[model samples]
Target: MPFIDEPAGTTPMTDTAAHGAASPWWQDRTPQEIAALAAADGVALLPLAAIEQHGEHLPLSTDLDIALGLVDAALPRVRAGVPVCVLPPLAVGLSLEHSAFAGTLSLRPETALAVMVELGERVAAAGFRRLVLFNSHGGNKALVDLAALKLRVECRMLVVRANYFRFAPPPDALPADELRHGLHGGALETAMMLHLAPAKVRSGRVGNFDSLGRHLAAAGRLLGPEGEAGFAWMAQDLNPCGATGDARLATPALGDRLVQHFARQLARLVEEAHAFDLARLDGGALDRAD
Candidate 1:
């Protein structure tokens, strides 16, 4: 069944089990608690997402919700007593491609990079040695990678940059063509939104963006990780609705499956970050190759 239409943000976002209900959020923790956690090899998860259009259906926070929700869901799956804290979401990111659409917001690339570094520096200053930059928006991908490298050098922290969707393989149910064409505002995103925040997903507003398919096919270009050659395109270049892909096939059932799968994979990723040590890269690491 389709979700009932509701205004954006009608549903509350997920909170954390990594810290537990007593102090589920990083901002809620006292300075002593934070420092103690940092000393325990704590890994800080920072979610970066864009406030942008997702056709006429999904909320602007779609990316943010997924990033945050996945973090929230994954936390408990981590073995008990692992020190990981999720910061409040950054909320806005690089959305230049969707800037033409109503309700879209973006930051300049340099500003975005600076903000990420500044946040990482503060985390390090607080004695944390690890940072996980969890991003959900496509536009933020390259910048997130750059931010991780910058944090590695500038903040002296073990930084891991990643996208939520990349953690798990796409569900086998998704068609092969969609694997390439469903770039944004597609079945995958819509389904996730349907599962994560059903109230925010408008019923019967699904749009088809086969035009983007035609455009991509004509250019002999590819999108996403499985590509050889990529093209520079704004969200509107391929679709007027500010959407691209076959969202008509999306369903809450599929969304539920994705949420579980993605959350499990993300939990594993967080565990890896928690165990990783910055000191491992020291001791003349650059001079040695194994």
Candidate 2:
């Protein structure tokens, strides 16, 4: 599906439309409305995701789903002092790694790079001084990094890509075995889905990890099976299931904690990054003693 543009009425508010508010941030705000908000605060949140296979139990657009949920969870926190708004998620991304999977949809990395660059320029023009690429899909990392670098140089605005998992490290919550095999549709993701979209999860669907290392070795030639090898050149191959972790151990309780933990951590990161002084520097000895 195509990305949704910010509508007119929505702007930052503690209460969500789901919570009986008329509009949330980015729903439908006039240019003046956005400008006023932007003048007050300089940051915006852009959610990034992929519409690719995520095993039989999860939705094809699981990445987008999770990203949107994270945005919802963060709305109140960011809106207090920031003119934070969520851009419609980019559903297609560089998914060539999972092409072997029947339901996996892939996009050229170049396409994402171009799209993100244009979006960043547009947002900058609209007056946001800082943009956060809140990413939920793994495949879009390189593309996001490239886009952030370009925006930083050209727009002179701080652009950052915050991966949900990496930003919010998993606690020692789940079983060691479950956590050990945890990467894709494993316990963590499944639990999040359970908490966020209980109806979407196929309760009957359950599976354990096959030997992970060997599977990764074979897939490494393509996508490198998660963290099997350092990034090189061509796209690494991946399994057809578009899943890597074991899902059998996933439960709703686990999912809730993980999601809440991640949301809180992400909120903290945004707070810190927003306050960071990107232009600060140590003495390079280029100046003579005054």
Candidate 2 TM-score to native: 0.79
For model 2, residues 16-124, the per-residue Cα lDDT tens digits are 3435642445546556656655675556778888877677888887888888887777665653564465666777778776676667777778878999899889888
Instruction: For residues 219-275, write the lDDT of model 1, one tens digit per residue.
Output: 765663225756677887777887878888789998888888888887888888876
Q: How many times do residue backbones clash in model 1?
A: 0
How many Å off is the CA of 235 in candidate 1?
A: 0.6
**Once superposed on the true structure, which residue ranges of model 2 sit more than 4 Å away at CA?**
1-24, 175-180, 214-228, 231-240, 281-290
Evaluate residue 148 in candidate 1 and report its C-alpha lDDT on the 0 to 100 scale.
Answer: 89
Best by lDDT: 1
Q: Candidate 1, overall lDDT?
A: 0.80
